[model samples]
Target: MHHWKPPPPLSLSLRSCRFVLSFTPAPAMSASSSSEVAPTGPADAIYRDRILSSKLYFDVPPSKVPVIYSSSYDIAFFGIEKLHPFDSSKWGRICQFLIKEGFLDKKQTVEPLEASNDDLLVVHSESYLSSLKSSLNVAIIIEVPPVSLLPNCLVQNKVLYPFRKQVGGSILAAKLAKERGWAINIGGGFHHCSAEKGGGFCAYADISLCIQFAFVLLNISRVMIIDLDAHQGNGHEIDFSNDRRVYILDMYNAGIYPFDFEAKRYIDQKVELASGTKTKEYLDKLDEALEVARNNFNPELVVYNAGTDILDGDPLGRLKISPDGVTTRDEKVFRFARERNIPLLMLTSGGYMKSSARVIADSIINLSKKNLIALDSPLGRK
Candidate 1:
């Protein structure tokens, strides 16, 4: 197996590095037009304080696009991440394809700060963060048994640090979405983790953290979660179960992992697909589901967990969605938010295959070509 390494510095001239993205913020977005009264009480006050003090919510200049990613998002120490089915290096690979194909400029991509411990406290319990200090606990959470043998410091640096960076990206995506109408964080969607637990290869509750930060920082009350990963998004479901402000629409293979019946109760709309479901049936169900969701909730922001694991031959997804099907699936979701004038934040959730990166890049390219998202070089002229 090949060891993952950071891409070498490009040979671009200094003049080329100064290209700026001239994107116009979407007009008449209901999310930015109004604000929800912030929640009160001591616990909420603490959460709000942490969010207010976070450095993850920094301002981005027009020179950078809303696509957030970093080479540090890849986990590759000792190659132990290969023990699991996940592509640990998929985030960097996705950006590499977009850059090499000229669909995106590397200089235009935004790099996010890592989510600090206090920033994580916005959603996770202090005890839960402490639990991750044990290498064995983290190993179990990620499902990589070999990681347990490593020292906790190495595990922290190699595994959890990347996840924290992704968590930061997820949190920052909401702010960027509110400004740009849409934002894509190429390495997030840790949907199986809750405030107190992390499992199913999810080490952090990035989705929950993102939404919580949105509630406090973005001043949005009504939020909708469109989770299309092959597995149930139990993390955010549990986190937002008692809160009426967040609406969840989850479509997953009920026959798969993390069958949390308790968390399933919280989903406002759940579409469970059986194993071996094909592309046509999947897309048809998505159409009906999106329609039902539109009628059910008028959310200010939409968080889309677009997992490419549904592609044909993904062992974990257990579905038969084609490459084109994936592309169309993304377009439908982008249109769902763009047409409604709602800010949208998309997280590249759970596609574990090596081809998942290429598939995701193609889908983003298609979104740009269809005028769903504004990028630096949608026409690939640069």
Candidate 2:
């Protein structure tokens, strides 16, 4: 396994917390299990049964496009969401912009169901799920102080409910991509949360859950995660650390949040960027990284964590990439997958600025213009 050497220490900021992570290999699956055996492990059986019984994977009619979103995906709790830097309503705005611009028809967009307790259990442990019932734990995970004071029931209904809806979107996106070649979840990419832990404003392991569901339902074995979010995607990295079926290509500002040196060891291909890196250098590195990733792994599916946080002027990302750079980046990734005929699913991961919605909508428009993704087909036209 490839290991990343930690960079020299730098001046610390409020958002940048440095931590050394110890690498521990997860326990291996038993050798007694073979293709001939019915795969009888209790843990494996529970996970498989949960996935097979999930309502998140319901069939969408031919009239609807593969773009997944729901009005319930937006979180607003007595205006307390304003306390956090994240734009809680960004998901809704992205879809609104696309509809107003004629790039998409509102009637054709698919609305996803909220992920239930059983669905979450496929990736999250029972204890971890129980921990979320504490309003204090949830507030800490989401980084909103006011949320801790609210009753656990209210918090669950208002805040975590929206996130669970987004999780459903992410999981469903994989299935849609398999059937349609490409799909996008307007929200999701909680890359900071894992099966047993939640941090960095991420409460659930959506990426990990999505891939797990894909492995079971889509009949896909090899998967690649192309996480271009500004922050390191430690959540999925940690979850898939011992699992060889997933290949991770993570490129992010190394100086940013969740500076997990341990999780860095899990990345199949790690591309670290410095603070305030400009657009030209960012795009150049991505081009090369994609080339190397192509040469290295042949995957049945590609999960692209397209975070707009890398946009210029974003306070959180600390990178200086421009709006057009974001568009070009998405285009390049789409082209890469399209050319290879590989199924791809994109998640709008993290971007705190309000303008993130516009940039994302524009990028989707650009993709449509380039014929990289079809927003509407004659058969699906409304």
Q: How much lDDT does each candidate structure score? A: 0.83, 0.85
For model 2, residues 112-158, the per-residue Cα lDDT tens digits are 98999999988888899999999999988888888999999999999
Worst 10 residues of 1 by lDDT: 19-28
Q: TM-score per candidate, in order?
A: 0.89, 0.91
**On a 0 to 1 TM-score scale, where does candidate 2 land against the true structure?**
0.91
CA deviation > 4 Å runs, candidate 2: 1-40, 378-382
Worst 10 residues of 2 by lDDT: 28-37
- The superposed Cα distance between candidate 2 and the true structure at residue 15, in angstroms, equals 25
Candidate 1 to native Cα RMSD, angstroms: 11.7
**Judged by lDDT against the true structure, how good is candidate 2?**
0.85
**Candidate 1 global CA lDDT score:** 0.83
Show pairs that collide, candidate 2: none
Candidate 1 displacement at residue 214 in angstroms: 0.9
